[model samples]
Target: MTILPDFRYIRPANVDEAVAALAGKPGAAIIAGATDLLPNLRRGLGEPSVLIDVSAVPALALVEETADGLRIGAGVKLAELALHPVVQRDFPVIVEGALAVAGPTHRAAATVGGNLCQDTRCHFYNQSEWWRSGNEYCLKYEGDRCHVAPKTARCFATYRGDLAPALMVLGAEAEVAGPKGRRKLPLAELFQDDGAAHLKLAADEVLVAVTVPNSAKGLVGSYAKIRIRDAIDFPLVGVAAALKRDGDKIGQIRVAITGSNPCPLPISTDGLEGQPWNEATARSLADRLNKTAKFQTTTTVGMRYRRRVLLASARRLVDDLWEKAV
Candidate 1:
């Protein structure tokens, strides 16, 4: 067995304790579930001296409904949230997304916050430390150039999270606890389009919760992911398309795709804001934007194959939504 690194583990009972523990420790890794972090450690990819465990913070695990919307605690396990009736009834997009994530074995241990803020992955980066170093470091690590795109000055790694795209379509907000205090911001605000960094969240901050908006006037939302297997596989390309219709005309729409870029690629559909949910309208918008999306060969499939599947996935979403309305 590969020997694990030596580290000091600190379990914080509350958010304050967690943030305080991380106040000035640049080398401290925030632990929630440890589903993603531990594996990297064992492979010698990441080695933090201090592990600040946030799993025991009760406030982070609490979720409840509110007058404005639902407050989903950061620590809520994916499996628990997938089975919640409220999630099924009110936010089927979220439920469906959760159900389609990783697998039952992982969902039970992985968390909502961790899923949203998971590290970006690539074919060249996720390997035994020795193996990756043997290939020379990629743009994501402390490397000189990208193995995927040697001429490009920036990283080409992809963000493969499933929940953030779903949440973005639902207008979700993330509540973060940091050394400064607690605050909530639009979920989309957390992500940075740059793959090298990927997010703007401070290292000391612990994402505490995510809240979904309550706009029941005319709600119709859907999430669809294209992956290699029926289960236990990350999506090669995922799309979360949510739209509100007034009578038969679309009032608002959010189109976001995961497994395509460093962050959720917000498909521009402003022209469809007041149009009906028609195949022609959806296809037109998709056609204009689909080709513009840059898909690198870092995912489970090649760039040509991934891009083709993404277009087909977008069409399938519109067709499925139309079928439901009938």
Candidate 2:
């Protein structure tokens, strides 16, 4: 059996304490549920000497409604977020996205922060140390070259977060706390194109909470994904779309996708607003998305197949939202 390496553990009571624990240690890793980190640790992906546990930080687990929209603590469990009545009522897209994450048991222990900031995964990088030792390691691990694309100078691991695209579609903001201070940024900004350094968060920064905008609330939306099985399978491609209707036309619209590339990609819906919702328009947007997204050989699914599914999913989501317009 693969065993986790030895590490110093520190549990902080609040965000400030958490930030302090990670202030000086570049090798320190933040753990909430350990659902994602523990597996990677056992696989010898990361060798952190220190672990800062923020699971019990009270402020990070609270989910409350605010004047803006909703404030979801980063430490909140995925199951809790999925089952929350307010989330189900006001943001069904988020509810669906959360529910689609993993099996109920895994989601019970997985935190929103962990999910949003989870490590990128590649077929070669996720193997056991012994398995990977047989060949050169990928750029995400100990080696200098990426196995997925050795000719390229960067890693091509896929970001597999389900909630990120959903939250991005709804115009969510991430509240990050670091040693210097706290800052709120668009959730989409948290992701960088590089797979090795996927998250934009600094080593000492803690993702405190995610706030959805008030305008996105009550907007008709849909979240869909392509996966091999019904449970416990990571999505091949995931799409989230939301829109506000004004009379018979769309007043505002947003579409975001994940599991398509190294980072979650948001399609430009600038000209979509004020356009009458229809299958033709949706198809056009899907075609544009297919041409715009960047895909690599990260997952088992081929890039062409993944692109087709993503475009089709986007088209279906748009059509569904239009039919169910409120």
Candidate 3:
């Protein structure tokens, strides 16, 4: 049986204590729900000597509606977020994404921050320790080469988080707390294109919350994804679309995707503004997404099949949301 490496567990009472713990410990990992981290730990993916638990930080558990839109504390549970009245009324897409994750029990224990900061995964990299050692390991963890792309120096592990695409398309921003104090940045900036080093957060930094702008309010949106199964499996490819209507035309639109690359990516909707919203337009947008997505052999699904399904799913979601808007 695979066993987790020994680690010291520290549960901080507040955000300040949490940040301090991380800054002081050289090999530290911030954990909320442990829904993702524990599984990875059992697989021997990480060997952090210290695990800082921030679930008790009251500041990280608030869900407030301000003039700016909504502020969701990073520690908010996925199940709670999915059932939040404001989220249900104003940001149904976020609710959809939250509910799509893993299973009901996972949602109950998983936090929004945990989902956002979850590690990237690949079939070759997420194997048992013995299995990985037998395969000589991959670039994401121990060895030198990326199993997905041996010719390239980059790791091709995919980020399969459901919330990222949904939150990103709505123009959300991430609030971070660190030794330098607090700062806010566009949520998309939190991630990079590299799988081995995907998150741009410093070792001492902590994700505090996520804020959705008032500009995203009143927009019609939808989230859709295809997975290997109906439950307890990460998405193979996911799509989220949010758009504003200008009478009979499009006012503004944004499309984001996950499980295709190391980072969740936004498909540019440039020049789409003020254009007629129709089936043809949806098809065009879908085609653009299919062309923009960079798929690798990171999952069991064939790249061609993933590409085809992404195109169809994006097209269908846009079409459905447009119909609802009309």
What are the per-residue Cα lDDT tens digits for candidate 2 across 1-326?
36888899999999999999998899999999998999999888888999999998999999999997799999999999999998998899999899899799999999999999999888888889988888777788888888788898988899888999899999999999998899999999999988899899999899999999888876888899889898788889899999888888898889999896788878888777888887667766877697657778887779899888888888888888877876
lDDT of 1 at 264: 73
Q: Which stretches of candidate 3 lie over 4 Å from their true place?
A: none
Reference-based TM-score of each model = 0.95, 0.97, 0.98
Q: Tens digit of lDDT per residue, candidate 1, span 28-133? A: 8888888888887887766788999889999888768888688888899998888887878888888888888888888998899889888888888888877777
Cα distance off (Å), candidate 2, residue 206: 0.2
Off by over 4 Å in 1: none
Worst 10 residues of 3 by lDDT: 278-287
On lDDT, the stronger of 1 and 3 is 3
- Cα lDDT of model 3 by residue, 87-167, tens digit: 999999999999999999999999999999999999998889999999999988999998899999989899999999999
Cα displacement (Å) at residue 75, model 2: 0.4
Q: Which candidate is the best by lDDT?
A: 3
In TM-score terms, candidate 2 sits at 0.97
Q: What is the lDDT of residue 247 in candidate 3?
A: 87
